[model samples]
Target: MTDPTPGRALPLEGVLVVACEQAVAAPLATRHLADLGARVIKVERTGRGDFARDYDTVVHGLSSHFVWLNRSKESVSADLKDPDQLARVRDLIAGADVFVQNFAPGAAERLGLGADDLRRDHPGLIHCSISGYGSTGPYRDAKAYDLLIQAEAGLVSVTGTEDHPAKAGIPAADIGAGMYAFSGILAALYDRERTGEGTTFEVSLFDALSEWMGFPLQYAAGSGHAPVRAGTSHPAIAPYGAFAAGDGVEVVFGIQNEREWERFCEVVLDDPGVATDERFASGSARVENRPALHGAIDAVLAGLTGDELVERLERAGVANARRRTLDEVLTHPQHEQRGRFVEVDSSAGPVRTLLPPITFDDGRTPRMGPIPDVGPGV
Candidate 1:
């Protein structure tokens, strides 16, 4: 196996990606390509560049989102409305393996950078478009921010507590769409290798997020009842939520089947009779009697410290985890031990980000490359 380090050739070392991307979704798609060693030329507005650059100044005067997504990219200033600069961007796309954009519904066509326009000129170029909704839907022209897509896709409906709906802390809609775009581009590239021709594809934030809402959607459709918002608890599963110990340390646990239920009763509760109790005999029974079940479990857990409870749960072969805050997760021991974090150079300074989740055959990570200035290609 080849060494999967910075000095060694990466999978996409020879590929070129030209991206006319501003916000999270399209930038995330191209960023993954850059992570695999593709040469990504990011085309931005002439002056202030990607508006996301102004989202915040949390990272030593740079936006954290921009720093996280724009690494290993060469940024070029462009004015699509100006013919000269538009031609420059076109020149970049002419030599690219992939061209990606997330312009509004009809903006690409107006700028002569639409998929059909580019593919007709360069038949071998893979073109991808990301938008709020799809091209043909009534909501196609509607603006779709991350939270807006989450609500429209039914994610907000199922998320958070029973009394209130909440969007995810992270940009789930943007992430879902970006991942779809990334995978779609990979599939298209593989096909192009065989056909010696490229194709065009589209990913919408609404579509991608809706696709991810599959399990809830299927459940609601089949049962004719929407899942109740259970906060930290599972809507369908029993004994699968956060519970606090005597010392107030919260631990989340789950009981999947009869065997696990029996073991949880005997090992964690120290009362095997509780398993066969009529109200808790089966998974459905336990869910129905969740109040009593929680009372019983809480009674047992209240006597033990969180660490002791976790140890006992491990011995019982129960799936469990300590409830951690975002800060705790940031400095999580597993991530640190696994060497999952790496420092990359940014316009502001060095910033740390997680390495791509996949590991190469050589058991090494990708090169953590630098973020670009507003006009690196100037």
Candidate 2:
């Protein structure tokens, strides 16, 4: 890997990561490591490479998913079943500080890339495995796609409207697993630095997303029923969702306390009496009578244009936002003003991407290296 600019080293500058990663989860973790300047060598299948590379050709004829997750890494294409190819991958990992993989449950063991075997030889190598369920659950062998894991982990149960429960537009389960793996690897690296011994850990999509479902899970266990699925709205909070203005533009806002609610009624609704009405007085009362409360809100909002309503909410000191489409988000003023977008090289061409979220106070930027094209077998 090329050296970072002198005197502006990234956090993982000297770290080396070898990743036998295919889809979203493992790729995301290694990509983050790459962002921090770790030299990530991604191992892929010989012919088609990562299957996600074919998910959709939306980004300059490159798969959007692959472009989103595989930036700043070197890819080595090899058929692991071949002795020489597998030996080459083993050699790469033998010198790596970190090794990550997300093969099918038993596939890694069959290929002799299992954590036990690798750790036995490289005692100081941090090994991470990501999977759909876990290594030893009844569902371990089950097919665990992102949507299936979302449904299984109760995320889909609490998402969308009551009549039409829906999975999140993004792959939440996969992302959750990826983030956990990323964090786990970081922690293990820290531990290795202190103790001179590496760590082996596993993260599963089902477990990761299940941890993310803490609120709804606890609510169900405590209240004896699942929270209602209210699309773009909260089940327990009032005045907390999208409302259309006279011009048909949607404005989303929320009231967090009695003070905000009173201000919202007086300024935005232009009716202070609505805040004291018995049907909508307290938080519980408003939630219980949400239909009536929304009706009253709609009546007032219908008389105001989107700009007028937003101005009123601002005057009332209530937090609010305009509902934006995907294209609008790409050019959002906040992102532009903050200089959050950057162009990176890819096989197709240069593509615009957002800078990594973590920022250094000293103005040091994360590595924004080129996306890799699959290379010939080692």
Predicted model with the maximum lDDT: 2
TM-score computed on alpha carbons, candidate 1: 0.96
Looking at candidate 2, the ten consecutive residues that score lowest on lDDT are 1-10
Residues 21-140 of candidate 2: C-alpha lDDT, one tens digit per residue: 988999999999999989999999988899999999899999888988988899899899999889999999999999999999989999999999999999999989999999997999
Per-residue error (Å), model 1, residue 321: 1.1
Candidate 1 segments exceeding 4 Å error: 1-8, 376-378
For candidate 1, the lDDT comes to 0.90
State the lDDT at 241 in candidate 2: 92
TM-scores vs. true structure, each candidate: 0.96, 0.98
Please give, for residues 232-339, the per-residue lDDT of candidate 1 as tens digits. Answer: 989989999899999999999988889999999999999999999999999899889999999999998899999999998999999999899988988999998987
Q: Give the TM-score of candidate 2.
A: 0.98
Q: Worst 10-residue stretch by lDDT in candidate 1? A: 1-10
